[model samples]
Target: MRKVLWIILGCTIASIGVLILRHSHVVTGGTAGLSLSLSYALPLSFAVIFFLINIPFYLFSFFQMGWKFTATTIGSVSLLSLLTSLDHLLPSFTLPSLMGAVTGGLIAGLGLSILFMNGASLGGANILALFAQRKFGWDPGKVNFSFDFLVVLSSMYSIGFSKGIFSVMSIAITGFVISYFKQKIALHNQPTPASVTQPLDNAISK
Candidate 1:
């Protein structure tokens, strides 16, 4: 039941995010953003490109992370790709580029936060972060930020300098917000004295 609920919720949030991308004409960060920018220049579906680009990362995640983590990542990535494809069918509209940048960033950040909290990823840099953490034990947040930075830097030609700059800012904001919430949640889930005492009492009783 929980998995089903997450599936439904994840797809819904991701679908809205893709709609925001379509309407705003603003590019995002990571592989999805790259796919969007390239789709503008080619005859490919953004979702298809997104899924294809993520495949290798998913394989990396499976080995470096674990099956449980990789399973959730797969579920989230697959749903996101499917929803993005379906979102294109819903409407054809546009919004101001700035508004698109802000709102799209917020929605993407929040949606990804939801997935991340559930032990999943929206794919791309997050998977790479897991690999980095496994190999170097660096902070995953910093690793993900660096990945986003490189992705944005590579976009100068495809998305132009000005828009690429905006994308960098948007991605930074989104990543900061997402990491903030995830950190808060992790803190909340830490063992408290009272909670820890209850487990000790149970063990003594047993």
Candidate 2:
């Protein structure tokens, strides 16, 4: 129940971030960016594209990350897709390009951070990133950043050079947030030395 709530919250936040980027006509990395790029040439919506693109990754998630994580991720991605589609119903507004880039990036980063901490993700590169972290002890953020850079670069022709650059910035911010917050969460969850030794000390005193 708690996990479900956190996943919903995380997906909601992440969808809002995606909405900001879409409203500003910007892109980010991962499957979301890929979907955005495809949306230009295809007749389908970004939400549909995003959801379809992630389908292949589920096999990998299931085999590598286990059923529980894979199920949670599917739920998270579905909610995000639905929410992002609903965003189109809202009244449109404009934002300055620079502000959009920074704010969108930060917002998206926060959303991704929450999803990651909760053991769910937006799928695509996120699944790969987590798998790499678990199998190879790699830093998921750096791995994600590397892939995101390539994804954003590939989008240059579609979104124009300037907007693609902004996409890169957004992904960079997202990667930083993932790395920083993961570390913080890890440290927070780590058993303290005092706690570990308390049992021994109490036994000795007794």
Which candidate gets the maximum TM-score versus the true structure? 2
lDDT of 1 by residue, 1-206 (tens): 66456545755775576568557765667787667667777788876777788888888878876787788777876777667767546657788767777777777766765555455677889776545544664445566667777777876787687777767666776677666664432322233455443332233233
Residue 52 C-alpha lDDT in model 1? 82
Query: lDDT values of the candidates?
Result: 0.66, 0.76
TM-score of each: 0.75, 0.83
Expressed as tens digits, the lDDT of each residue in 34-152 for candidate 2 is 78788989999977887788888998899888888899898888788788779768998977667777787788777777777667887899888877766665777888889889888
Model 2, residue 178: distance off in Å is 0.6
Supply every candidate's count of residue pairs whose N, Cα or C atoms clash at under 3 angstroms. Answer: 0, 0
Backbone clash pairs for candidate 2 read none
Error of 2 at 97 (Å): 1.8
